[model samples]
Target chain A: MIEQSINKEPIIATDNNGIVIDIRGLYKSFGAHNDVLKGVNITVNKGENLVVLGKSGSGKSVTIKCVVGLVAADKGEIKVFGTDITELDDKQLNAIRIRIGFLFQNAALYDSMTVRQNLAFPLKRHSKSLSPKQEEDAIKEALDNVGLAEAIDKMPAELSGGMRKRIGLARTLILKPEIILYDEPTTGLDTITSREISELILAIQKKNKTSSIIITHDMACAKLTADRIVILKDGIIEAEGSYEELEKSDNDWVRSFFI
Target chain B: MVISLKNIFNDAGNVTQFTARFFKEVLKPPYEIKEFIRQCYVIGYRSLPLVGITGFIMGLVLTLQSRPTLAEFGAESWLPGMVALSLIREIAPVITALICAGKISSGIGAELGSMKVTEQIDAMEVSAIDPYKYLVITRILATTLMVPLLVVFADGVGVLGGYAGININSDVNLLNYFSKVLESLDFIDIIPATIKTFFFGFFIGMIGCYKGYTAASGTESVGKAANSAVVAASLTIFVIDMLAVQLTDIFF
Candidate 1:
C-alpha cells in the first residue's frame, strides 16, 4: 500500500535523539464506566511512526487524546517533548499543543472558510506578526504539498472527500508541527483513496521528520506507515511489534488483523 | 417535572460557567481583532434589514392597536406621546432583541454547534488558536455592542412607523408627531432602556455561544443547540426586561 511519492525522504535526521512523547501509567474513564485506558504505557522515539491499532471503543483514540491534552487522563503522566502535560494549565497546554497537530476522523475543516482561509487560520492565530506575503507563501506551500493547490479558493463543501482530507492535511501541515496524531486517518474512504492517504501520511512523516501516532483499524494503513505497531484491547496494550512480526503472532485475535 | 427542573438548573449552571470562561478568555492576549470586526459585520451589520422591518411593523401595529382604546377617552391627541414613550422605553428594545434572539442567536448557536460536532472548534484548539476568544468573545462583544445600536435605530424607525400609523386614519404630519414624541420622552425613559439592551444582547450572545460551544457530539445536537439557544435567550430577555423595569421604577 505504500506507493512511492515525489516527496519521500528519510524520517530521521542526524540531530534526532531521545524521546519526544512518553506516556506512563495512563488511565481514563467516562463517568462510571470502567477504565478506558488502564495502566497504559507508550513511548514515541523522535521521528518514528508508532501506530496504535485497536477495535472500535478500544480507547485507541482516547490514548492520543490524552497526550494532546484534549481529553485529560484520570491518572497518567503524559510527557510531550519532556513536559508533563497532565500538570499544565490551559495556557501551558495550548503552548504544548502548538507543537502537536491532531487530525480528527472527519478532517474537521472550518466549513465557513475557504481552503486558503482554513490553511491560513492557524498561522494568523499563532503567529500574529506574520506579514501578508509570508502568510500567502505558507498557505500556497501547504496546499501544494498536499497536492491541492488548485482547491485553495474552494470551500470545504465544494471539495470531494479525498480533497477535503488533503485540505485537512494541508491545514495541519501549515504549522510545521513536531508531532502529528491521526485519528482513523482512512476510516471511510475507498481502498485506493485510503492507500493514497496512507502513502501521503508516510510522505509527510518522512518529509517533515515528525514523530506520529497513527490511530486506525485500517490494516493497510498500519502496514504501510507503522515503523512499530501496538495492539490495544480490554483497556490495555495487548501486543507491540512490527507489521511482519505481528502477522506471525500465535494469538488468533492479533493474527486476524493481518488476515 | 422534577427532572425538567433539574435539567434547567443544570443548564443554567453550565451557561454561567461558560460565561465566566468567556470573561477569563477575553482578557487573554491575541484578542482576534479581525475576527471580532467580522462578527460585528455579520451579527450587527447584516441583521439591519430584518431588525429594521420588524421594528417598523411593531411600532405601526402597536400604535394602530392602541389608537381606538385611547380614542374612547378622547385622548386621541395623546397618541403620539404615548406611542413614543412606549416604543422608546420598552417596545423597540424588547422587540428588536427578540428578533435578534431569533436571527443572530440561532445563527451563532447553529454555526458553533456545527463547528463543535464537526470538530472545527477542536481543530482550532489543536491549531494553537483560542477557540473561546476567536468564537465566543468576538460574538458576545459584537452582540453586546451591536444590539443597542440596532435598538436605537429601531426606536427612530418605530417613531416614523407611529407617524405612518397615525396618518393612516388621521391628518397628523411627521414633524408634528415627532414633536409630540419628543415632548413625551424623558432622559429617564431612554437611558435605562438603552442600557438594559446591552444586557439583552450579552445574554443572547452568551446563551447561544454556550449552547453551541458545549453541544453534545451528534448531528441532532446541532439543531437542539440552535433551538435551545433561541428558547433560552428569548426567556432570558423577558426575565431581564422584567428586572430592568423594576430597577428603573425603583431608581428613576
Candidate 2:
C-alpha cells in the first residue's frame, strides 16, 4: 500500500511570486509495457529549495529530467519559468536552458578540459556579453565560490571526488541560473564533505535567492538544505512538507527515512 | 523465431528514433567547437598508423599472392596496374573503413554507452549542456573528416606496398611499376571510391553514436552498444559500397 500524506492543495508561499517550474500529469516509459513515471505532478516556487526524496528506481530523476526536457515525457506538461518546455523546439529549449544550472552526480566535467575551462564552458556558451577577461573573471569568481580557485589548472581526473563535486558546483554557479537542479550531490561524499556541500548549497540559495530542486536519497542532506521536502514513490508524490512536517507524519515510508 | 523477429523489429525502431534525435539535436545552437577538434585528433590522427599499416600489408600480400598466377599467363607486367586499381577502387577504402568501424565505432559506442548506463549523459543534460551535440557531433565530425583522410593514406600506402612487393620479388623496376600504376589509375576511379568513404564515415559515426547514446538499462547495455555499433557499421559499409559501385558503373 502507498503512503498518502501528500496534501491535495498546492502549497504556496506569499514571498515567492513566480512559479519556477510546474509539472502536471507527467508520464514516461522506456518501453511500451513499463512506465517509469506515471502521472507525477509538482510545482517549485521561485527562490525555494525543494528536495525530492525517493528510492533508487522511483523516477525522481525522471521527473526532474522531464522538467528540463532532457527526457521526453509520453504525456504531460512541464512549464519552466512559465514557458511550456514540452512545446518548445530545440532552439527554444536551448535558449531557456541557459538560465538553468545542473550539477551532475559525477560532475560530468569534460575529461579533456581543465577545471578552469570546465567552469568557463557554460559561460562561454551562454553569455556572449562577457569579454574574454570578463569570462576569466567570472570563472575565477565561480571557482572561488566553491573554494576551488587553487585547482583551476588541474584536470578533473587529478581532483579527488569531493574536489570534483566542488568543481562541478563551481561550473553550475558560473551561469548564475535562477533554477538549479542537483542530482545526488552528496551520494558518495563523507559526512563532513557532504555537510560542507550542504552549507555551500544553502549559502548559494541565500546569496543568489536561486530556487533549487535537489534529488537525493540522503535524508541528512534533505533536512539540511530543503525548505520543503517531496517524497516520490512509484512515480507519484507520496508526501510533501517541511522536514518537521514530514518527520511527524504517520506514514511508514516517510518515518523510515528518519529512522 | 517469432520472438527473435520481434526483437529485431524493436531494435530497428530504436535505431530510427536514435537517428531522429541526432537530427533534432544537431540543429540546436551552442555547439561544442573545441570538443569537435579534440575528437578529430583522437578519431583521425590517432588511428592513422593502424589503418596505414593494415592497408599497406593488404596490397603487398595481394600483389605477392597474385604474381605467380599472372606470371603463368605471361602477365607479370600487369601486376602494377592490377594492384594499384584494386587498392584505389576497393581494397584500401573498404579495409580502412572496416578497421575504423571496429576501432572508432566500438570506441564511441562503448564510451558513450557506458556513460549513459552510469547516468553521466543524464547529468550533462541536467547541467544545461547538450550531451548529444557535445558527444555525438564531435564524434560524427571526427569520423566524417578522419575516415576520408585515413582512406587516402591507406590508398597511397597500399599502392606503395604493392610496388615494393613487386620490385623485391620480381624483375619489375620501381619506376616502371609506379608508371604503370599511374597510367592505369584515373581520377574517375579514385574520386568516386574516395567519395563513398565519406558516406562510410557518416554511417559508422552515426550508428556508433546512436547505439551508444540511446543505450539503456544496466552495464550490459554498454557492451551491447559496442557490439551493435560494430555490427551496424560493418553492414552499412558493405551496403553503401555496393550502392557506390552500382552508381559508379551507371554514371561513369
Candidate 3:
C-alpha cells in the first residue's frame, strides 16, 4: 500500500497517492437558493465505496461530477489520482478521464447504437491496437459482469428501464476504469431491481477492485453499496460515517434520511 | 414582444462565433473520415430522390404554365432557352437547398437536440470521446459538401424535364430539345450557381448543427431546435442566393 498523509491543520488533505480522489473546498452553483457546492471537501481511498447521500437537489450529483471534471466548479481543487483535474486542458483532461467512469442518472445510452456497438465505442477509441477477437471478448466480459450478456444484440430503445441501466453500466465497465462515479443508479428502479443493481455495484467493487463514489437518494442503495456514507447538505458534507453509525445519529435532520 | 436591435446583433455575433469555432475544430487532428463518409451518404445521396422529383415537376410545370404567354407573343421557340437558363442559373440550386434546409437541417437539429437532453453527448465527453469532432464536424461537413452535389443532380433532372415538357405538346425530338437547352447555358450560368450552392450547404448544415449542439435541455427544446433549424437554414439560403446574384451580376 502506498503511504498517505492526512493534514490535520487544513480542511482537505490531498498529499497522498493512496487517496484515489481528494477534493478540497469544491464549489458550484446554478442560480439555486445557495451555491450548489459551497466549500465542499471529500476523499476516496484506494479500493473503497464512498456513497454521497443527499436530497433531490442537494448537489450530490454535482459533487461527483466535479471529481470527473464534468461539472466545472466556481472555486476549489479536485484531484483525481493526485492530479488536479480542474486545471487540466482538454487533452490532459481526456487523459485523466479514461481512468474514471461516470454513470448518469438516466443511463444516457446512445439511441442509434446496439448494446454491442455501444460497448465497443470506448474499447475501439482508447485502445488502437485491440483486435476484433479481443474487443469481442472484452464486450462479452463486461456484459457478463453486469449480467446482461443476452442484451448485446438489442438496441437501447428496445431495452427495459433496468436493462438500459445495466447496459449503461456495461458500457462504462468495458473500459475497465479505476474509479466509477454512479449518479442515482437506482432512482427509477423497482425495489427488487434496485437491490439487484446495488448487489452489482458491490460485486464490481470486490471483483474489479475499483474505487467508486456513488451519489444517491435511495437509502437502500446506500446501505447495500456504501463502505462510508457522506451526507451532503447546504453544499457541504454534514455527516460522514458507516451506515449503522449515521443511521443512529442525534441530529434530527441528518437522522431524517434514515426514517 | 418587440424585436430589439441589440438582440439581433447579439444573435449574429453568436452565430458568427459559432461558425468560426466550427472552422477551427473541423481542421484539427483526429479527422473522422469513416463517419464523414457515412454522413455524406445519408445527407447527400439519400436526398437525391426528393430533389430530383421536385426539379422535374418544377421544370415540367414551368414549361406548361408559360406556353400560353409565349403563344400570345408567337415566341414559343424561346421556351427551351428561357427555362434552361432560369433553371441552371438559379432555380435548381435555390429550390434544392430549400428542400435540404427542410430535410437535413431539421434531422441534424433534432438528432443533436435529443442527444443533448438525454445526455448522450455528455456521456461521450465523460467517456473521453471527442463529441465535437465526431458529431458536429462530421454532420456540418456532410451538409457543406452534400447540398452542392444535390443541386447539380437537380439541375440535370430539371433540364431533362423541360425537354420532355416540350416533347409532350410538340414533335420536338429529345436530341434537338437537349441540344437547344445546352446551347442556352454557358459556364457563366453554371459556375456562379454551383459556387453559391456550396455556401447554401455550409449555412444549412452549420445553422442546424449550431442550434442543436447549443440546445437547452428538455424534450420540448428538441422539437424547437428542429423547427428553428428549418426556419433559420431556409432564411439564410435566400440571403446567400441574393448576395450570389448581386455578385454574379457585377462580375458576369
Candidate 4:
C-alpha cells in the first residue's frame, strides 16, 4: 500500500548534489529586538534524517517554518527541491507545499473532524482524482503505517497525546510527501512514548526513503533518528556532527546537550 | 494612550484588509458548497428556537405595553396594525439580529479562535488549503444568506405573538387581527427592513470571523475573541440599522 501510494507521485529532480532543501543567509526578526533567525544556513540531503537540537527560543522551529514558507523571512533564500520558495506566489508556493508534510507539536488535527476526516482532508484536496474507495484505502494504509487503525473514528479530543501524534503522522504520511518536517514531534510524550515516536520516525525514513528535518529538543529522539545532528544556538548552527561525535565534543555547551 | 490609539487604527486596517480578501476569495472557483451548507444549517437552522422565542416575547410585550397608551387616546383598535408595523419595520429585524450577533457571532469567534490558537489554521495553510476560502468565506456567506431569512421568520413569529397578546385583552379573531396587520404593512416597509438585515448578517459573520482568525496565540485569547465578537457585531448592527433607516427615510 505504501509503495502504491509512493509510486503515483511525480518525482522532483534535485541538482547533482541531491540537496532537497538548502537555506542560505536566512534572517528573520519578529520586531526590533527579537531576532529569531540570523544568517542561518542548512542543507538536507535527498534521503536523510537531519535532527536540529536547540534550546527554547533558539529559532529552530522558525528556520524549518521558513523552509516550508509557513513563516516568511525578512531576508535570505530558502530553496526546497532546488526552487527558492520566497519568490513563489501563492499558487506556486502551494504546489511546492503539497509535496511537503508537516507534523506540528500538538498534532494540530481538526478538532471538529474525526481522525478519518483529518487524514482524508489533504488527500481529498490534492488528489481529487482518487475514487472514494481508493481514498479510504489510502487513509487505512496511512493509519496502519502509524499503528492507529483503531482510532480512525475517534475525535482528536478523545485521543491521548501519543495517539494524537501518531494520528498526526498518519495524516502527514497520507499525502505521500517527499519531505516531512517534524516540529517537536515528541515534545510532550513520556519517555517510552517518545522512544516509540523516535522509532517511528526512523522507520518512516527507512521505508519512505524521504528526507526530513526533525526539530526537537529531545536528545533521545535525536540520538535515535538523526543521520546527522546540528545544534542550534544564538540563531545559528553552532555544532554539526553525528550524535556520538557531538557527545564526545570538546565544547562544554555542545556536550551539555549530551548530559 | 497613543499606543492604544495606534492599535485601534491597526485593527481597523487589518479588518479592512481581511474584508477585501473575503470579496476576492469568495469570487474564485472550487467554491466549498458542502461546508457552506453545513454552516447555514449550524448558523441558521440551529438558532431558530432562540430567535423564535425572543421574537415572540418582544411582540407580545410590545402589544401589551402599548395597549394602555393607545386606550388613553381611545385608539385601542389601532393596536394590531401599529404592532405589526413596529415589529416588521424595526423591532423584529434589529432584535433578531442582536440575538444572532450574540449567538452566531460568539460561536464563530470562539470556534475560529480555538482553531487559530491550536494551529489548525496553520495546518490548513501548510496542507495547501486556503483557510480564508474554507473557513471565512463559507461562514460569512452562510450568515449573509441566513440572517435575512431568520429576520423574516422572526417577523412572522412576532406577529403571531402580537395576536396572542391582543386576544388576552379582548376577543379578537385570528382573521380580524391578520387583516389589520396586512392593512398596516406596505411593500416599501418590508423591502427596507429586509435589506438592512442582510447588512446586519454580513457584519455579524465578518466581525466574528475577523476576530477569531486574527486571535493572539493563547487560551485566553479565545475567550476574548468571543467576547469582542459579540460587542463588535452588536455595535455594527446598530450602526447599520441607523444608516439604513436614514437612507430609507431620505429615499422613500
Please name the candidate that would achieve the greatest lDDT relative to the true structure. 4
- Give lDDT: candidate 1, residue B203: 93
| TM-score of every prediction relative to native | 0.94, 0.88, 0.94, 0.98
Clashing pairs in 2: none
What 10-residue stretch in candidate 3 chain A is worst by lDDT?
Answer: A1-10
Q: DockQ: which candidate is best?
A: 4
Scored against the true structure, residue B52 in model 3 reaches a CA lDDT of 93
Query: For residues B123-167, what per-residue lDDT tens digits would candidate 1 score against the true structure?
Result: 887765778888999999999999999999999888888888998
Candidate 3 local lDDT, A1-259, one digit each (tens): 0001111112122337689999999989886656788888999999999999987778888888787777888899988877888888887788777878889888999999999999988777777667688888888988999899999999999998899999999998877778999989998899999999999999999998999999988899999999999999888889999999999999898999999
Q: Sort candidate 3 into its docking category.
A: high
User: TM-score for chain A of every candidate model?
Assistant: 0.92, 0.92, 0.92, 0.95
| Reference A-B contact fraction recovered by candidate 2 | 0.47
Chain B TM-score (model 1 vs. true structure): 0.95
On residues A1-259, what C-alpha lDDT tens digit does candidate 4 reach at each position?
A: 4334432333243433899899999999998999989899899999999999989999999998898788999999888888888998888788788889999999999999999999888888777777789998999999999999999999999999999999999999988888999999999899999999999999999998989999998999999999999888989889999999999999999999999
lDDT of 1 at A29: 93
Candidate with the greatest TM-score versus the true structure: 4
Q: Which stretches of candidate 4 lie over 4 Å from their true place?
A: A1-16
As a whole number from 0 to 100, the lDDT of residue A254 in candidate 2 is 84
TM-score, candidate 3, is 0.94
Q: Identify the CAPRI category of the predicted complex in candidate 1.
A: high
* Cα distance off (Å), candidate 1, residue B185: 1.1
